[model samples]
Target: MKLKTSFIQLPLLFDAQRLLAEINALDASCWRDHPQKFPGNFALPLISVEGDPANDGVAGPMRPTPYLEHCPYLMQVLEKIGAVWGRSRLMKLSGHAEVKPHVDLNYYWRERVRVHVPVVTQPAVRFICGDEEVNMKAGECWLFDTWRMHRVINDAAAERIHLVADTVGSERFWNTVDRGRDPFAGSVTENWHPETFSGLASPSPPRLTYESVNFPDVMTPWELREHLLFLLDDTRPHEQLARVRQIASRFITVWQEIWAAHGDAPHAWPIYREKLDAFEQQIHRFAGELKFNSNMSFIEGMNGLIFIGALGDRRQPTATQGMRRAS
Candidate 1:
């Protein structure tokens, strides 16, 4: 489901002191690794493949990292979240650092949500998704729509740490969301505290001249593109696409034979696919000798030469012809 705000406050909270105690126990080395996706930033793994939080792609059989040992309470809270999780980690935004705004584009993110539980924060640390911004406070449980362009800034004097987890939502997760409040609708601003919250996009002006075909009437074109690329993925496995590819392959086969007849398909169905296959070997032999791009282009040119001439002879009747015959 599309979220109502830039961030959603799930109906769960942790003890600030206890969460902070475990967070403070963590050493500097855990956050030292170069981030895989968020380059030049810092993160530490809690539950992830090979215990590397930076390895953001993997979503199978994740286990707890050594750092998670310190926060049994945090793990307990995670268990209560009810999501079949992928990764959980601690992300530290050092003072004066800024996480550049970007949208996540990957298969893993299409159906998954990222949960942020702040363990350490200050007023100057701002979390911005699209246009609206807020300072996520310590011990607050929040979820943001990563499908949108979002980023973070630590203008405070100290590092800001957030316990973040990635998960494909569960029934329990949605239940919490249903019960959760809409903070944005209530006018929560940059001064947003633990006090209230939801629209990551509502109340904001809509961008039309735009068409959204994906999730119905609401999304703009850019949002739909992001949804298709990352969420829906490629058009592979589509029946029409499969048929198109098949025709493309057959066109190449039909062309090579047409060329051998010296640009003349004197016979109606005038191309032996077997002969075309053999001729393709010579095209491969002098691959670099072409005036145009590649042997592929040469094949395309052959198809172009044969295209109009190849049709019309003994052509099958259309539905119109069938209707006329019946009449």
Candidate 2:
């Protein structure tokens, strides 16, 4: 999601050593290559679809994998964040590796904010977002704008690892974010103090909230309108902007009318699909060459957010056809 700044350091800290101990105890076989197979990038699932460690899909009910059930301190780390979690993992960047610069246009990411807790990292590992870059130290909590183009580079000889989690955020989480400081905001942390997790072992299991409904069977008209407005507002100036807006306005009007008539009933699926298909063709015709400020194509966002997910399954595109994985 977009933020007021490229990065926000939350007013919380964790026991990096204790977190690392839990990480170390885990078997090496659990780590998997990046879903896109970015060289030298790997991950170990903490939460995933149906609690299956091998599943990287963003849709379906999210649940904790066995990997999470055995780690007390990691659970404590998550609890302190105070948010309903989505797919999460321990992201590892091998020495000398880098995460290529890219913006996350996935529909799942359009609403969710990714949280980063640096469990193991070096000063030389720099996270670059837009015009700014920062070396997130171990145990520090942070959030970044996924909508902006960003990347990570590890110049150090040793590997770097971080606990990366996602959430739509909760009331408490937003409150915490309100208290957070942007790293570029000029010594904002001088007066602000942070709460630290001591990493004491838990006596019982931690009960955490997980997402049960992420994608929609048929998106509500209000939400679809909101997304359309957001995209139009974010589009960079282009010769086609005026015509695209006209098309979008007409499409939204038709969608709202259909929603009034059928309201996501199974019988309405065909109508919804037909309108969605028409909209897709119109959008691609006018806005295919247009791009967001983040350099992602506007059609990519439309496909990811509306075409594939707005009304249950349409035929899915190949990995190369739509938005690529952000992490």
Candidate 3:
């Protein structure tokens, strides 16, 4: 009834070509349509199984098809982590979609574990749990404690595939079931304690700071415009919009500090005036968009506009007029 963390590596490398071919053969449109649960495009019914008892009763748990039975590599890896074969489920994920952060509601209080085998992936696929962010490569297997908050995102251009399995019963059951193999090997010793292992006291909630906000590296002015356009297009949650404004304000402050540092330079005054004017205009735009109240913390809103606007298209405008026209 407690949470635990452990580590295990698979015995074999995944066969990417075979997995891809199998994925291509299955029907994935349903998953794509209902992307909040299983994001992006993907194939399914690679196996036969009874439908979900909780939701799709009478059919039993869904099973993968016969062709994928050869992927015993995942089974072997789970065995190393003291997981049983029959108790697990199989899931596949594809590119540019994400399962938002959430805890496993069904089995968190029990001693179950979820294992993942990355059959194919790009570096942008990240599995995050609490403070840990893991990027799994092709053929790598990982056993994560989903009792705590966890989420997966595939931001890559290429697709990704994973075989998901869950283990039921106690750690003792797993140890006895496997026999002679040490499942706890290399696992964090503190994981056996639920209080420490469950991430209950991980830290203070993450502060939304200016530096924590991501900015595209080495972006040109035209690209910056496109970035802003993208932000405007997307439907942002209210909290995110507020964060964007806060971050923007901080950036303007930093810029002002730089200007102050170079006040003695011959061209510093004119450059500062120009930059300040443009930055102030951006602040006004973001403030207008967010309808920020006057009581909000000061940074002059310029940083926020810059942050939002920087998510623009990369191709430079043909001319300054073109840039003006796009905006």
Candidate 4:
């Protein structure tokens, strides 16, 4: 999610010792290579689709994997965050490894915020986002603007591990963020009190909530308009932007008319598909050369945010056909 600042330091801390212990208890085989096969990068799924650690797809009823069930404090840590989780994992970057800079362009991440809790990290580990860089200390909770170009680098010889969780964020979560500190801000919150999780606390299974409806069969006209406006706002000024806007306006008007007539009835899917296809064709005619300030193709963002899952079978979980990894 976009943020006013590049990074926000939430007022929360965890027991790094206990967090590391739980991670260490997991078998070496539990860690899987990065899906894109980035060298020296691996992730152990904590929360995944149907609790299957091997499943990386973001759409579905998320569940706590066996790995998460084994870590009592880890559950407590997430419970304290107060958000319905999507796809979460323990992201590990080995020494000298770096997460290449890229904006999270996936539809799933359009509204979701990625939370980072540095479990095992050194001062040399630098998280670079846009023009700012910060060394998130062990046990610190943070949220960064995933919409901006970001990457992580570990200069130390030791591996760096962080609990990376994704959520749309809840009221409680945002309330905490309201009190959070932006690193770029000149003044610090000297009296800020962070809730600390201690290992000595009694263990109790946390009743965590997971996301079920990530994407819909048909994108609502309101949502489609929002995505279009956001993309247009982010797009670099171009001669064709006015034409693209007009095309998008017409599409939304037609979409609203169809929605008013058919709502979400199964019979209306074909009609929706036809309109979406026409809209894409018309927009790309002029928007093909348009690009966002971040260097992402405008049409690519359009497909990911508004087109791919805009028309599908609502009776079943949405398919992950064109969904890109949010890396």
Candidate 5:
């Protein structure tokens, strides 16, 4: 189902008072630098890698931290959020701090939807997603598409704390959403899955120069493709996948049209080819980086998947294989 709004409030609610007391009991010093830098605060990892939380900077296997084991109350609350939670943590932002506007661009982002359960918040704290904004209160559970431009700003005099967890939407989670507003209901469009690519005409050979363009309003085409696939991976029911598949198919097929124009206009294609190659390379490098984060196999599977295969030759080496081989 297409999302009806920018944010969706889950049907469940929690005891804000108990959650706050439990969060406060955890050792504040344990929080370390969040990879996002988060404007200017640390994160208390509830779930993450097996190694030292001080060292790990990204997502990995669903490892439970010492802190998680310590707070039975908080642990019970996380369990209520969903059945499968990955790379979760208690994020704390200092008063008056703010996270810069950005999108989560990796394969993990495409595969997970982050759920927020606020433990401590005030009216001054605000979250902005695309054109809309909300002041999420304590004990509230909310979610938004992270692939879109979103950020948080805590203007309150006190710190802002939240229980942030990721999930590949399960029946329970979708049930919660369906109870209120269904976000994943839609049929795939035909144009999104292009006509077969069997006998397309060949274009003339051309010189190549690499250059990139910047767009301030949203993510580039490459980002959108990954995001689309991620959404497809997380969503439930087989039919919803078709809508994402069609959109992805259209995106890559359009590039083929531009690539075929190289015979008539060689100069621009070479430059664009360079940029596209660089973007594909970046995807590989990112996949390699996630190897230690316990995401090596997850990313590897994406290559064989139909959604990414829509790009035809434009697709890069699967993140796990070629990039790791290069390293």
Candidate 6:
């Protein structure tokens, strides 16, 4: 409802003409060519532009570019938020395109608050933050705790553009973020010890197994698919397939590790192998059903081939042929 913090307006304003020019110059074709990056039925690539405010080696996640570079209006707005938080890049979403509801997990949760300035919008574009729906107007700014559940949707026929920026938090908030840091770098395994595996030493216990995990009652299948598409869109099909394989591979590794630690029972190896086999077959079946014809399709095929090679079953042809076919 009420965002954790109140939003303040910045003095900087962007040249709409320049902003439109830049958006037009971008290679929208790249996203379309590689459908795998952005998948699902509704997720479509409108445009993406990059700018460097911190001049860090990596491009920060997508946001408006014009406002970040030269919008004096935005800079003044950030000044009100506090001195520590500076203006980051801004990203504009065109047409009725909308970003799925997601938490800013990578950043902003600690002490940073996200600010949104609606540069151009129609009534159909709604910004949902928690339970509150805010209809932004041109030149108006709002500071919100984006760490909570939030999403933007454009149901309007016209394009909706907003200047999204990130600012630093108060000293107390920064301290909380610092305290939550992972002491063992980014890997949870580093903190794991032999004693942590003690629970697996006991005989295998029955656990719930299902073909798929359903979404919570609050979300319908279409809504869930929309959210997934937002995540999947932007990569080639092969990339999506690779990502899926990577997840499966990690699961297999964990299973192997458990078996190594406590697989003395007669049923352990057979059961584990059977589960892996079933998973592999299921993924292959999904790949076949995707009807991949675009680059995304080819990528998915490559992932399937990789799985086939990794399993080293005689039924699958050699990696050489698989590679040839994928190419």
RMSD of each: 19.0, 1.6, 20.4, 2.2, 18.6, 20.0
| Worst ten in a row by lDDT for model 3 | 318-327
Q: Per-residue lDDT for 63-153 in model 1, tens only?
A: 6667876666666667656666666677777788778765543333445678888888899988887577877777778888664567788
Expressed as tens digits, the lDDT of each residue in 18-72 for candidate 6 is 4444434544432121112222112112112233222211112333333233333
Tell me the tens digit of each residue's lDDT in model 5 across 5-56. 6677675567767767767777768777665344466677776555345534
| Residue-wise C-alpha lDDT for candidate 2, range 228-263, written one tens digit per residue | 888889899999999999998998899999999989
Looking at model 1, residue 227 earns an lDDT score of 33
Would you give me the overall lDDT of model 5? 0.54
Query: What is residue 150's positional error in candidate 2, in angstroms?
Result: 0.4
lDDT (tens digit, per residue) of candidate 4 on 81-181: 88989889999999999888877766778899999999999999999988999999999999999888888989999999999999998999899889899
lDDT of the structure predicted as candidate 6: 0.39
Give the residue spans of candidate 5 off by over 4 A: 1-4, 36-39, 55-59, 181-327
Clashing pairs in 2: none
**lDDT winner, 3 or 6:** 3
Which residue pairs does candidate 4 place in steric collision? none
TM-score of each: 0.56, 0.96, 0.41, 0.94, 0.57, 0.36
Worst 10 residues of 4 by lDDT: 315-324
For candidate 1, the lDDT comes to 0.52
Determine which window of 10 residues in candidate 2 has minimal summed lDDT. 313-322
Q: What is the lDDT of residue 129 in candidate 1?
A: 76
Task: State in Å the error of residue 72, model 3.
Answer: 7.8
For candidate 6, the C-alpha RMSD (Å) to the true structure equals 20.0
Q: Please identify model 6 stretches exceeding 4 Å from their true place.
A: 1-82, 169-327
Among all candidates shown, the one with the greatest lDDT: 2
